[model samples]
Target: YTYNNRINRISIIQEHVMLRRAIERGVSTERLATALAINIAQVEKRLNLLDGICAETADLLKDRQCSADVFAVLRRMKPTRQIECAELMVSANNVTMAYARALMSASTPDRLVNAKRAPKPKGLSDEQLGLMQKEMSGLQDQYRMAEQTYGEDTLNRLLFVQEAKLLSAQALTVIAQVRFAKRQTSVDFGPSAGMR
Candidate 1:
């Protein structure tokens, strides 16, 4: 739609695309900034919009109307956390910088890019955050295990159904053959067959 392409609905992403194209065409950054009427810093930032971002997260947000600051927030977390945050944003229809920061805040230190340098929440003590992190990690593990089990169960059920269908087809073929055999054996005798 015009809103997406021209009206900056997908602002940073569209700019990134244009910037990449210009860069590939050997356009200087200053020239690009002048052409786009933005500063060189912004032009460079747009060019590196997906620099540290994982492909999956970028794909998830490529079409959505997300704040550029959201990427800056996401870039702080590890790839897995970035993916989780992106999925949350997409599902909840909220891609503001605040939401991204909230998601980052909820993430365990281990999921951060530099766990040692990770920031703590304003209210929660380190001990409390650790406890919450453990609980969240446990829940994530349970979800992954359940998902694997469900996938295996589904595959087994499908294989069973396919086997059952094949058996049914074979049974039908055998029944048909038996009926033909019976008809062959029950052929009528000629009028003088008994006398012969």
Candidate 2:
């Protein structure tokens, strides 16, 4: 059972790494299975397990009212920095979307059918155009920052996965060996065994 548990944990880590890399590279699970020499069902099962693990991990993180060793390990093992970066990117995207919508409404008369602000100029002056351009430039900067963060997050996650692979492999191996030894051992005692 211990051996199985260790193997399960290692497999979970490996599957997570593989799935993340696949998504990052835009590769489908079917293709990942083919690449990894595993069947589609195996990949799917691992993916499902990973999803469960992720959900549990997330719940554990959210419940600040409790404590668990697993959460501590997960915090260290999981790519939390990448997660934060991704969250920041998402917020930045929302800001960019809002800014773009506002700028577009400010620039185009037909699109501002519902806006409550003062009526904008039917044709933008050089000053207004430059202002719009400046807003757009800021949007571009946000976009670039998001992209850079994403790239760095990806690299960091990849490195994290590599470390997990090594640690998990070692753990699984030791657990398996212990399990094997336990299974092979037999404790035979006479009826007076408890006499000691």
Candidate 3:
């Protein structure tokens, strides 16, 4: 068979959606397997990959370059939790199956789709789970705060560079304006005022 270069690489969601559409259009799993050069069981697995996933979660991950196994892990999570985990994975630039599994393990039982059969992490007690959830929440808050401050931090650095490029009086004036702005914003300027 000739390699089909026209078929560009597709994401996990695309593969699942395509397979699902084929099945819905009365395509046989055996035929799909032959066309994709995979086994019938694998074709069926792909077709059913999004069986229990919510539309919102699927939409969130539609463009993500996650693996099929990542979706498999995500399917165990509730819709809201799935979105949160997907966001974290995207922010961290990690969409691996292992990362998905770690997120699943870190999730609280209430956040799982099958709460009655929630998978327990090895060596993790209930207390540990609670602590992990709290720590994850705190880390997520810190990540958001850092992201919000990133542009301001860049602007501050540029202002410092501009001040350094100017003459002493201009530089001092710029520094004073910056300090005044920082004070107005309630940002700590530390003991740098003593340097002047």
Compared with the true structure, all predictions reach lDDT values of: 0.83, 0.52, 0.83
Candidates ranked by TM-score, best first?
Answer: 3, 1, 2
**lDDT (Cα, 0-100) at 105 in candidate 1:** 74
Q: What root-mean-square deviation over C-alphas does model 3 reach?
A: 13.2
TM-score of each: 0.63, 0.28, 0.74
CA displacement after TM-score superposition, residue 44 of candidate 2 (Å):
58
lDDT of 3 at 116: 76
List ranges where model 2 is wrong by over 4 Å: 1-140, 187-196
| lDDT per residue (tens digit) for residues 25-86 in model 2 | 88898898899899988776555533423454443233122222222222322344324322
Candidate 1 lDDT trough over 10 residues, lowest sum: 3-12
Score candidate 1 by TM-score against the native: 0.63
Q: Is candidate 1 or candidate 3 better by TM-score?
A: 3
